[model samples]
Target: MWLKKIGGLVAILSLSFSGMAIAETTKDNFYLQVGSNRNGDPIVLDLASVKGTEYTLLEQHGNGIERRTLRAACIQGRLFSRRLAVYESNGHLTRVDKTEQEIFPKPRSADANSMEIVCRVAANRTK
Candidate 1:
């Protein structure tokens, strides 16, 4: 009977250690939907594809009809901004570039928009 109890305790310990390992390997994703732009077009941002210190930022508009992807690396780099700004023209994604600091001067505030939030979260995760 004591042998059975020992085996059970060993199993429980192994399971708990495995759970911690899984949690360490797992990556988190952040999703947010900001309000519409000047043309009343909705915008959405998803940061799900995280690998190490890098992640992919997926931006969608007009209910996913318009999509833009930005490969963001949160590691130490020369880039001033980690998040890429998606420029839309006439309800279409036209260009993507590193976001300007001036655009999100108060990024840490609770009222920050989706882009600022994603940028901050991604950078923090890298650290």
Candidate 2:
């Protein structure tokens, strides 16, 4: 059942991105939309900043934005935020966190989608 749900979500994401061009939708060419979360907030991955198993993810949250450095454990199929920066709506940096919290993304959540995308890319990079 869990596999089925993840597959269904992947299908939905594929369809959603099929009609849109990444360059036209994102603010810049370096950021690609991974997918939106349950709340419909856009989640984007910074393509140029990806290094090995780490990726930079930018997410829209309410009236603010968050930039996170996520380390994808491709083998374990999980990821954790190594660093985070919260920004105001005007693009002002409000807070920066350098904590090494290892919170796994919940199933079927936006973070799950991000983990799935990042892990897939990271896995492919090794091959």
Best by lDDT: 2
Q: Report the lDDT tens digits of candidate 2 across residue range 39-116.
A: 765677766677887878777756777789988777877677899998777678899999987877777554666666
Quote the lDDT for 51 in model 2.
81
* Candidate 1 residue-wise lDDT at 55: 39
Each prediction's Cα RMSD?
15.7, 9.3
Instruction: Give the least accurate 10-residue stretch of model 1, judged by summed lDDT.
Output: 17-26
- Which ranges in model 2 have alpha carbons more than 4 Å from their true place? 1-28
TM accuracy, model 2: 0.66
Q: What lDDT tens digits, residue by residue, belong to model 1 across residues 1-127? A: 1112112222211112212211111124333334334554434344354344333333333333333433333343212234553434334445555553322224322113433445566678767
Error of 2 at 8 (Å): 33
Stretches off by above 4 angstroms in model 1 are 1-30, 49-64, 72-115
Score residue 83 of candidate 2 by CA lDDT: 96
